[model samples]
Target: MTIKLLAIGKTDNKLLASLITDYQNRLGHYIKFEFEIIPDLKKVKHLSETQQKEKEGALILSKLAATDTLILLDEKGKQMHSIAFSEYLQKYMNSGIKQLVFVIGGPYGFSEAVYNKAQGMLSLSKMTFSHQMIRLFIVEQFYRAFTILKNEPYHHR
Candidate 1:
């Protein structure tokens, strides 16, 4: 199955972009991975938080297919160890899915519509992280999970 990461906005920080790119390259060695960014909304000064979320939700929903399993990276979502995450990936692949889509919502988080569409949610840590940083973390974790699945030496535990 192909894995896709859908996130809001682009990472302008060069250091973070470099790190994210490195992990993306490493992950490509294991599975088909794609990272798509939804451009940030313009003129946010006038829009309310709810309005922003609704607009962003529309964009997120537009990118999904009927059969796609939507997973949101949320703070209140399920947390799993690296090995468990690998098994999770294995399970999805075994199910013969065409694509597994993971999403990182906007600054105010996801709208009610986006939440309703998601099949599952996962959290990388208890600590809050910037949206840009989460991109790096998730990609690295994907690489780590694949390496662990292959019995590679990348992960120590």
Candidate 2:
């Protein structure tokens, strides 16, 4: 199965972008991985939070395929340890899915429509994180999960 990460906005910090790229490359060795960025909305000052979420939700939904399993990285999502996350990945792999898509929403988070479409939600941490930073964390975790699954030395190192 191909794992895809769809996040709002581009990673602007050079350091964060580099780290995300490194993890993405590492993950490619185990499974097909794709990272996509949905451009930030323009003229945000004119729109309400709900409107922004609705618009972002539309963009997020547009990137999906009919068969893709949507997973949202949400604050209220189910939290799991790295090992358990590895098991989670294994479960999906065994299920014979073509694409598993995880989304990192914009500043206002996801809309009701986006929430309704998701198959599951996962929380990386209880504390909040910047959208750009979450991109790095999620990719690194994906790399870590794959290493754990393959019994690679990287996880312990």
Candidate 3:
């Protein structure tokens, strides 16, 4: 299955961007992967947190295909170790899905609609991370998961 990551906003840190790219490239050898960025909302000074999440949620939902499995990288999501994550992905691949999409929502998090549409949620850590930093972490984890699945030395068990 093709794996897609949809995150809101662009990260300005050059180092982080470079590393994200590195992992993404590595993923190409194992599975088809796509990383797309949703432009940040403009002029949100007047909008309340709820309103902002709603708007961002609409944008996030717009990027999905009807058959894509949507998984949110949420603070309240199920947390698992890298090996378990690799197994989780194995299940999806065995299911023969066309696409598996994971999203990183805006600063305030997902709205009701987005939450309802998701097939599952995954938490990389209990501790909160910057949206930009999460980009790198998730990409790297994806790479690591694939390595583990392939019995490559990239992941040290």
TM-score, candidate 3, is: 0.99
Q: What overall lDDT goes with each candidate model?
A: 0.96, 0.96, 0.96
Displacement of the residue 121 alpha carbon in candidate 2, Å: 0.4
- State which candidate has the highest TM-score: 3
- Between candidates 1 and 3, the TM-score winner: 3
Please provide TM-scores, in order, for all candidate models, with all chains considered together: 0.98, 0.98, 0.99
Better of 2 and 3 by TM-score: 3
Q: Report RMSD for candidate 3.
A: 0.5
User: Worst 10-residue stretch by lDDT in candidate 2?
Assistant: 148-157
Deviation from truth (RMSD, Å), model 1 = 0.7
Candidate 3 lDDT over residue span 99-142, tens digit each: 99999999999999999999999999999999999999999999
Candidate 3: list runs displaced more than 4 Å. none
For model 1, the run of ten residues with the poorest summed lDDT: 89-98
Model 1 vs. true fold: TM? 0.98
For model 2, how does the per-residue alpha-carbon lDDT over 25-91 read when each residue is reduced to its tens digit? 8898999999999999999999999999999999999999999999999999999999999999999
